[model samples]
Target: MTQNIGDALENSTSQASLAHSRKISEKIEQAIKEDATQFRVLTGDRPTGNLHIGHYFGSLQNRLRLQEAGVDTWVLVADYQVITDRDGVGPIKDRVYSLVTDYLALGIDPKRSTIFAHSQVPALNQLMLPFLSLVTDAELRRNPTVKSELEATDGRPMSGLMLTYPVHQAADILFCKANLVPVGKDQLPHLEQARVITDRFDARYGRPKGSDKRVFPRPQGLLSNAEMVLGLDGTKMSKSKGNTIELRMSADETAKLIKKAVTDSDRHISFDPVNRPEVANLLTLISLCTGQPQVEIADEIGDGGGGTLKKMLTEALNEHLAPFRARRAELEANPGYIVEVLHEGIARANAQADATLAEVRSAMNMVY
Candidate 1:
């Protein structure tokens, strides 16, 4: 009788676990459907150089997904935020246009998604004034992304703009009244700071105690499932590190880079990121491109060694990126098209930003 009770208890626990998992899965499906049909998504990049596959897997692909879902998408070319650490802006105009061209080549429709230069949006900058006042210095100093960036600059003196760029980000989001900010885990802290500022601003100058409407909706982070794409050297893919596969690289260049990528000497192929990060990173990259499981990729390669893996990766990447390169080449031919896209995006962005800024000023009684 005691044995029967034990078996019954175990069965009950298993059933409960399965039920819970089903509930969670249902919620996730619902969220994905909702995101596809309705949401305001804000996501962008700082154009320091040509974007790598890391940028694509990390954010750009997700942006395209949402845009296709009919979600209101806004992509910012954060030009103003680029000078926080660097001294002189090197060919910033070319970089900005390159970034826009890449966006167009990747299927980010200028009509469906508003893509604009951050520096050109005056209302976004104006919104920063009050937002700056809402956060404390200590809070700025504590931002993890800021700390990592400062460290990357190797103990350089912290610039004021660098410290308060999180506030600038808040303005970027709120100026467009963004309710969903797609981000990686590393960026959660920045979005959290944005939320804190939004709450404080709403309390200070939002609708009266009895009113229902509020000025700014506290934005939430839509955390990405994608992992941090490692560079050829098994570190972060960085332009400075010279270990990135740029999105626009030709097939030969990509093949050369993959050939030179660091990998282990072990004859066996396996996905062990901790022990064989180089090999595992390659497999991860392949999986991302091919939509195949890493285990399957490893099994297929099966003791063919790193050389076999690199060859496979090279072919996969070149094949995958061919369309993107062709599209970008076409866009490059008509440089005026890139300029026109930016101008149209800027006009649309300014109109939306101005409307939001007017509401903000009125709420703060700055409408004299």
Candidate 2:
């Protein structure tokens, strides 16, 4: 059971907090608009499993927006991070290829964005050593997201890698000095830790005596406006649960999944998320897909029972995902092309990461 990054933030959310996040998002957008080249976005998932609808709506869409806006995008497969909680690494390269296809299917242009596997960048991982020294064990233990994930591990002994996840995440963002990260509220703490590391490291060394610039810019969290998309069972969509509508699923497979969705017996459906979450979850999906409000969709499907609701959702979802599916099919067939994409991305990442590492070494007076 993979725990979400922000299980602790559930209790901390409020209108005021959301408003603050939105304000920050607006500031970043304006900054990017003024000078897109001055900003870079670091976003991608660990090669855990097939990315589901939850990923698409939650994070993928925002990354696309940033790329389309001409911001430099660095997408990391985070291959090493997969070993954090598990004894087995599983088929990481395969997962990375799947994730890349999902990205391509969903509009991640390799030409416009650099996508690379974590293990391919040695200089990037090397950052972990100095970064580890910058933070205390107490500080690492204090991260709320880390705490939640530890609990999610179901009492398995926490590995050192797991404990240092936030630091590793910091390496991902700072290795290339990405100034903006697409994150939800739960990940704010993770981003904050990266900022902390950047601040401390910059103050300690590496800015070049009078270059008038810090070694690394403290990256900001680009808070998302996406909603929490529930799975068929009215719970958070997760790959482990087999409740997700994965981007790679066939149209028929998607329809079958929706058909099995748990909806209430109430023939008269309304968008009452707090009361009838299962049906409301279906409404939410339809709304996200069709760009129509949940209430309106519920009204249209009123008294039609769960069957009609599922049917509507099936059509809307499939129609919305057809292009992505078509592109994914072609990409899946062209395995060689995917390798080329990964190779190009890895080469680009190597140059960027090597430069960053050189600066870090020089700053710490360890440039032997």
Candidate 3:
């Protein structure tokens, strides 16, 4: 009887998993059918450092697609969120500039997308107060992304700001009235919280169904199709790990880094990530940049071993990044160009954020 009960539980769990997957598929199909112009997408990165290839494939490239699809895209620098864990702001100014430059070089047209620093938008900050009341401390701590991030800090005590990171993100989404957010599977929980907060606020303060006073739109996650790009060490690509290839790195720098990448002694070239992570990582990088299948890459590098594979990867990477590097160099030479772009973004963002905040204040009866 005990074994029978366990089998039944396993079947039920499997069924639930199938249902969830079907639901996600339906959402993706619906999103594909929707008019892109109707989507106001809010997505961004923290200006902690230079973006890596992982960032390029994972989010930046998708942002370009969405922008070109006629979607109104807002890319936030999220500079304010940097203090949640770090003790002091280290080279934030330079990093912010680099982040914007990376975006532009990679095809985020400033005219088509609004790219602004988080700290520069005071109205977004103001929305946090009312938003805080809508979420609980327990809910904040339960977020998987927050939990994983804190765990990565090696037992560092959580800060108040860190605990409330999801709420702040909610403000970022709603302030712009964005109806879509681009995220990976791991970030779904963060987007879920944003949706929950929107529902609660709408229920509590929104007008009748027919009224025009509806404030926040429930933001939906537009899951990215890009596969996760692992670092040369076969771990998540991170700047702190010293394994990432930064977008700003020259061809020589990239080649030098790839040459030192870890790989196994297996005489055969294959794409088995389980046993041959290093080789698989190299293949994944090649496939992403070259638009080739991993199986094809494995076939091409047959029996040539890790040395030949690394050389091929280095060549492919240089070819892939050459245009981006040239464009970045041209933009970097005119440092004032970045400043002007940020200022324009700030102005546009402020106008939208201020309007949203005023509506929130009026809804909460805080406007005197």
Candidate 4:
């Protein structure tokens, strides 16, 4: 409530975006009078595992709204980053396909937007060279997300590919010349890096009297307002944590998971997340799924103990997931539809990436 709700909501529209939800909140608070319709948006996800409720509520749902709102949307699979961060790539193809299935199930029509894999379009990575030259090693080391990731991996830095992940992301956004990037609070630094790089590039080659040619636009953060949906264990809802509720989970599985969700022993059903993280998380999930306010939901469960709350949450979650499950089943049966959709996205995305790469090459005088 203390933050800018508008920017937060916009950032929630793109959690994986470079701008944090909090930054977006402030920007929106400041720019309340301007029309946002002219903006082109870019955001994406890593295909590390199955899509979950956190992703849906935090980002994908917002993407659907953006699409309907007439914003030009570009959603990338981020397959290349996934490979850079982790080791084994055995089931990479399956995960990418599953991600594609998620887009279709969530109503991300390929005809209305561009959706593509990071690896399929090779040109995007090439921009990394020029983009990287704009920043120093210390700058990369200072990035919070990058530092957190490196620390999380126990100081085991991956290959050069992983080290330069931010540049790749810059290429992703600059390729489309996006004006808006919907991201969560944690990713703001990356976007800032992109902004700095864009500015540097423009300054060096921008079209002034007796000046060079400009190639990119510095995009602003759209910041999402989505609250973090915690997993069963009160941590972020991630598949790696084994605490996520899969987007395509069956009604029975959802009920069972809700029932098993960690909650306090307190007999009261309240919205006190500080003391009652487990119960509060369940309430949060239910509220997100049911479109009911947390206080209203807490009032409904009033001191009935964990079982009653769990039961209520189970019912709400299952009911909420009914439509998505149905859609997922239909999409899963016709695997070719998913492939075709991605192929179409890949083609469209390639055109955009190719053009951006051409401009970069021309600006640097790389052409023969």
Best by lDDT: 2
lDDT of 3 by residue, 93-174 (tens): 9999999999999999999999999799999998898788777665676676566777887877888888888889988889
lDDT (C-alpha) at residue 284 in model 2: 90
Tens-place lDDT per residue, model 2, 62-146, is: 8898899999999999989999888888987788999998998899999999999979999999999999988877667768867
lDDT of 3: 0.83
lDDT: worst 10-residue window of model 2: 1-10
- Mind giving the per-residue lDDT tens digits that candidate 1 earns over 178-225? 888876545656766777777778778875334477778877667566
Quantify all predictions' global Cα lDDT against the true fold.
0.83, 0.87, 0.83, 0.78
**Residue by residue across 144-208, what tens digits does model 4's lDDT show?**
66666778887576567766777788888898888778876666667766777887777565543
Model 3: runs farther than 4 Å from truth? 1-34, 149-156, 208-213
Error of 3 at 259 (Å): 0.7
For candidate 4, what is the TM-score?
0.88
Regions more than 4 Å wrong, model 4:
1-37, 207-213
Q: What would you estimate as the lDDT of candidate 1?
A: 0.83
Please state the error at residue 287 of candidate 3 in Å.
1.0
> Clash number for every model?
0, 0, 0, 14
Candidate 1 at 259: error in angstroms?
0.8
For candidate 3, the 10 contiguous residues with the lowest summed lDDT are 1-10
Ranking by lDDT: 2, 3, 1, 4
TM-score of each candidate structure, all chains considered together: 0.89, 0.94, 0.91, 0.88
